[model samples]
Target: MMIKWFMLLFTGFAGGLAVGCGFVAFLSVLGIIPRLMQLTKTIKWIRLYEWAVILGAVSGGWFSLSPVYLHASHYWFIPIGLLYGIFVGMLAAALTEVLNVFPILAKRIGIDDKIVMLMMAIVLGKICGSLFHWLYFAGL
Candidate 1:
């Protein structure tokens, strides 16, 4: 029994570490942080950005997996939701930028001249979907 519990704990820790390392490696290979810094002209704040990413991942993981909950007011969720949206948007933008996905997609689809419109539509769709999800699900 003791050995079984130890093995379970070790396996869980090792699996988590492997997944975490792969996630960080993916972001690094995609050059998301560096590209973001370059685009924003905030290269000097690279360390700050790196630390923010690390802290955010750690705190987010803890908050998500732990049974503890903060009984914050509904108003507090506004800023939290905004931050989540910004993070997701940045990640999606980084992925698209790294792969030149939008341009290639537009050219392939013969919408080269309407690339901006395509992007705007995607953004609007994301916003509307997110809003609908929260509004509809919150009632449940």
Candidate 2:
């Protein structure tokens, strides 16, 4: 029984580490952090950015597996939500830029001349969707 429990725990730890490494590798391959740093002109804070990513990943995993809750007021959610939106927006931008997705999509859709408009539409749609979600689902 003891050996079985030890093996199970070890396996779980190994699996989690593997997944975490893969996630980090994926972000690195996507050049998300570097792109963000370049755009923000914070190349000197590279270590800080790296540490933030590592800590965020670990904290996210821990929070997901643990039954921890924050007792913050609804007002605090505004900044939190904004930060989440910024991170998601940056990640999406990085991925699209890295893969040249926008150009390819524009060419394929015969909207090469209106690529800027297409991008603006996507941005506006995302903003509207977020607003709707916050207003309807979150009641905020």
Candidate 3:
């Protein structure tokens, strides 16, 4: 139980940081930011965002899997993780279509950035994954 709270807070913070950094870098690269900045010449922010993304995903993966670690046999977590991956993918795809905000924002910004979609997908996946794990344990 203590470990669960720790993982929750850790992943939440890590994911939030990544999402925030990604949002800023995304806006800059997507041409949404005002032309005055011209920040693309220096891709240091992009590097920071990329590393944040990798860090967040890894940390959140550990955080997200804490439940399975607690309840499952040593080998069960492996298959469960694979199943969760599939579920996250499907949830992400459906969410992107339903939200519609990304496309409109991108259209307004005047550039089609695929990375924008990728970032949104990651966030949606994490949220949906948390719910899925909750439901799984609740049902058992």
TM-score of each candidate structure, all chains considered together? 0.92, 0.88, 0.29
Over all chains combined, what TM-score does candidate 2 have?
A: 0.88
Candidate 3, 1-140: lDDT as tens digits:
99999999999899778977886675445443232123234454666655755676677767876865466585786688668775555444444544565677677767576757756666777868777886688674
Which number leads on TM-score? 1
Score residue 113 of candidate 1 by CA lDDT.
97
Two-way TM-score contest, 2 vs 3, winner: 2
Pitting candidate 1 against candidate 2, the one with the higher TM-score is 1
Q: What range of 10 consecutive residues in model 2 has the weakest lDDT sum? A: 31-40
Question: Which residue pairs of candidate 1 clash?
Answer: none
Error of 3 at 65 (Å): 20
Backbone clashes, each candidate = 0, 0, 0
Off by over 4 Å in 3: 1-72, 113-140
